[model samples]
Target chain A: AQTVTQSQPEMSVQEAETVTLSCTYDTSESDYYLFWYKQPPSRQMILVIRQEAYKQQNATENRFSVNFQKAAKSFSLKISDSQLGDAAMYFCAYKIPGNQFYFGTGTSLTVIP
Target chain B: DAGVTQSPTHLIKTRGQQVTLRCSPKSGHDTVSWYQQALGQGPQFIFQYYEEEERQRGNFPDRFSGHQFPNYSSELNVNALLLGDSALYLCASSLLEGRNSPLHFGNGTRLTVT
Candidate 1:
């Protein structure tokens, strides 16, 4: 079974600052995918970023980037220049090829203006 | 293009009652997946439908069942629902052929069992 773990329950960052959310996972599969999803108060789950296990290079989308250390099974999300709109519940997820996704408990992020 | 869309944005039902939720996949998407998100928690996969059949399921009870139509739309039906079933149900869609295709999610249907 694959399990994703997000250690941070809640995080806060000042506007224009940076914050990193830690995530680790346990999986037997060699090839899989990792993802970060953000859910705002509106209740829509939006894809923040994704990383492929085989790719050594990390994935970054705008201000959102991931530090994917495959050997250590660590995938942490880094938000640079955080904005107020970034305030949401961020979830770490793992998925194998052609399988369902395993998600962590989620970390609530509050961007203080 | 329209993203994944779910019907009845919010629903309230009594315990032991039955409820059905509908989902329309995004354009060019061939797969539909259902997930349950409890309060202050991440989404948990319930099942996935492809080719009008169930391809994968998670650790959910038989009381939860689903169907997919030829057009790739799907329906999730919960029978004899329990209070624990009160949560947000999210529908996501993606292309089956793309190994790394990311899921496009709907706004989700908030189901409350009283």
Candidate 2:
């Protein structure tokens, strides 16, 4: 069985600042994947970024990026130059060797002006 | 191009009654998966459909059933709905069941079992 954990239930960041959301997971497989999903107030789940276990390079998509530490079993999402639109519930997810996705409890982010 | 699309943005049903939600996979996608997101929790996988067959399932009860059409569309039916069943039902589409595939989600249907 695989499990994902997002320690912070809530987070806040000032506009144009950087914020990091922490996440950890427990999995038996060596080869897997990690992801960060953003769900805004509209309740639409959007993929922010993804990382593969084999790749040491972190995934970056504009202001959204992930610091994936395979040995530590930690995958954290960093939002740089945060804007009001970045305020949403962010979920950290884990995909096993296969594509079975497991999500964390989620972190609700608030971008303050 | 159309992403994963689901029907009935919102629905309300009484207890013990049944409800059905529909979903159409993204263009060129062959796999459809269902997920249930409760209040203050992450989305949990209900099941996955590939080639019109159920390939995998979660820990949900038998009361939750689904059907995938040949056209790659799908429907999720929940029998004897309970208040706990109320949540945002999300439909996702992936190319194949592997690490390389990423799921594209729909807006989700907010089902309220009152």
For model 1 the TM-score comes to 0.98
Q: Give me the runs in candidate 2 sitting further than 4 Å from their true place.
A: none
Q: Per-residue lDDT of B20-79 in model 1, one digit per residue for the tens?
A: 999999999999999999998889999999999999998899999999999999999999
Tens digit of lDDT per residue, candidate 2, span B1-114?
988889999999999999999999999999999999999999999999998899999999999999999999999999999999999999999888454688899999999988
Q: TM-scores of the models, in the given order?
A: 0.98, 0.98
Compared with the true structure, what per-residue lDDT tens digits does model 2 show for residues A1-113?
89999999999999999999999999889888888999999988999999989999999999998888888999999999999999999999988655679999999999999
- Candidate 2 residue pairs in clash (backbone atoms < 3 Å): none
Clash totals for all candidate models: 0, 0
lDDT against the true structure, per candidate, is 0.95, 0.93
Q: How many clashes does the backbone of model 1 have?
A: 0
DockQ of each: 0.86, 0.74
User: What TM-score does each model's chain B reach against the true chain B?
Assistant: 0.99, 0.97
Q: Tens-digit lDDT track for model 1 on A1-113?
A: 78899999999999999999999999989999999999999998899999999999999999999999999999999999999999999999998888888899999999999
